[model samples]
Target: MQKATGQDGGEAAVVGTDGTGPADASGLTGDGTGPLAGIVVADLSRVLAGPYCTMLLADLGATVIKVESPGGDDTRTWRPPVHGDMSTYFMSANRNKHSIALDMKDPEQLELVHRIVGEADVLVENFKPGGLAKYGLDADSVAERWPHLVHASITGFGTAAGAHLPGYDMLVQGVSGFMSLTGETDGPPQKGGVAMMDVMTGLHCAVAILAALREREGSGRGQHVELNLFMTALSGLVNQTSAYVAGGAVPRRMGNDHPSLFPYGPFACRDTDLIISVGNDRQFARLAEVLGMPELAQDEKFATMSARNENRDELRALMVGRLGERDAQQWQDELVEVGVPCAPILGVDEGIAYAEKLGLDPVADAGGVPTVRHPVDYSRTPARHVKAPPHLDEDREAVLAWLEGRGADCEG
Candidate 1:
């Protein structure tokens, strides 16, 4: 494990007091390994949003104990593409956490869970509105007992007027107008291929938890944070949302093209499709030169961003004609060399390879399966080696032992 150093050469380290007390949980015990050295997380969320949030925390050196309700997270069985009998979707998110399959229905097991929560610094759950309250683990209930615990809740529509409504990424994409802004003008609305809304909401949850932890440093108290897919989707709509709110225009799907910018989309080359991002007039001018249509830059219909946007269809056809003369890679190289933002749309495998080649290390070997890597990088206290997502109930004994020791010391 490399020491994650900050820009100022300070080693980045976790600051929380692990339930096992200060000395034992601070850093690795003479073995020289560990990422999250002192933080404990009881992860109660399942599927994409909640799991992703905890995974991020785990990647950053938190000791995350994932609590599964017997059947195992539904994602564990969600597979057309399975490795080691594990769903790729589940593998993608639940890394660096010790899994504990407990039947919360059993009163004794439920009591154990309460004890675990009492010893944890953070608790993350994505149950539907009031779903966890019956089990005595909702934010208010848990925070009442564990005042220092940072409790995070993930919901689909949020805990407001829409709390009872179940939120799904595709549904939110549809209801929040994301789908309406995708696809071609005459085509059906298309949701994103990936569950991006869930992913984003997960990211938001992680961010909010970290902020709450920082606040706890001064206040010595924890906070309950709530994140929802609908709100997250709406916030992510960005330009589309702004257009509807301010301009009173319902945006339509424009397929592979920018709504406000010309030539800021994909064009078909001879062998493949290439995405070009001609952001401003200068880029457009450069694009014209690159395409052997330098004269087009001076044409009034395609001179400025506004003018080019107005005549985007015409400009797109012209660019496509010129672009079709060469292969995508060749065109991409030429455009990129001239400062035009462009790329040949690569598949997932190719994207992974590209990131690896650039030393980005997008995924890491967790336990045995490859897990997506955390995006943030620190200099002094660098992230540790990837740990595979745990098998169900894998670390219950060890986690319980650590907690019991801590509880005993607190009593002493």
Candidate 2:
């Protein structure tokens, strides 16, 4: 395994391994073997969306220098759930990167920031439409100064009519009609438990940045990439949005039930609820066999997928009656054995444990902090968990040294 020097000149982490090894001094990993090993990102955004996008790039082996204000990212104080002195929430989206604090109001510090952006391959910011214009760090300003830079901007809404509105995931959920479709049929509109809009927007921003970087290779110039939470929320709604636009049908909440497919939601068993997803007529037939009602697959009422959907009320009654004969775990085992898609409801811990049982290895250690692993795996160049999230201005000295051409690696 390859090793990197930590701030204290001790071994920080083992890089180029499977990421399940001893902790490093720098809390960093990776051996410059990732696909994006040589790339540099100037992360000017704070909070979830911008940080999340930059973290993805960092995992893929980019040298991400997180530029925060003197107060640091707002999430540093979003605590009650913390690790040591850092917020776990903040840590969730910030890893494998170095952090430095700089106040743009200070002319010297702003100059330093400009130098960083000038050297970086990409710049990511989530400031409101014109929030960065005063600092001369906005898209147009950056394009004029650094034509080879990929400038990616994220907002709550587009720059035109909705620029004044603050961007928040829950607010976008309400405005984009996601909340309206999230709850039970009779219940009040509800937001998702997580900030899904922010996450989706981050993913969209990352893709756009990658595309612009690819284009720059061909044209020797970069372009501005823009994304907004409201638009991302609409695109993420997928089928529901299509239902309204393409079919002229407004969708409504249906509890855990799917709008188009029957036998695709949770059903009560003897001891607990189990989700049985039947995607096609053949899967429905296999499910019928598992329930000891093979004849139901041939019945006119439930024979075809459309017929089963149309008569879901009656078919659900029958299936529920049959499922009630066995415990959810028992049914899960039998259904899975026959290739019918089914699983008992699991808590978050149980879900992680299940993934572990299946050899997915969903957790990784950054320095000493535990984190969810990056979701993608590459054959030639896998994602790396280089460093733990930084403390407020923790890497100031090394970053400054690098800025001064000293070539020093940041301390943990």
| Residue-level lDDT tens digits of model 1 in 1-412 | 2222211123323233332333234321112234455666888899899999888877777777788988889898888798776778888888777777788898878876776676677889999999999998887787776777788999999888999888778989989989988888899999898999999999999889989988987886788998899999999988888888999988888888778887887789999899998889999899899899999999999999999989877888898888999999999898889999998788899999999998998977766677667677787665554567777777666656555554422111
The candidate maximizing TM-score is 2
| Candidate number of the best lDDT | 2
After TM-score superposition, the amount by which residue 123's alpha carbon in candidate 2 deviates from its true location, in angstroms, is 0.3
- lDDT, candidate 2, at 243: 100
**Model 2 off-target regions past 4 Å?**
1-30, 406-412
- Which 10 consecutive positions of candidate 1 have the poorest summed lDDT? 1-10
The alpha-carbon lDDT assigned to residue 315 of candidate 2 equals: 95
Q: Which stretches in model 1 have alpha-carbon errors above 4 Å?
A: 1-36, 408-412
Q: Which lDDT values do the candidates have, in the order given?
A: 0.78, 0.83
Q: Compose the digit string of candidate 2's lDDT tens values, residues 127-230.
A: 88999999999888888877778889999988999999999889999999999998999999999989999999889989999898788777867789989999
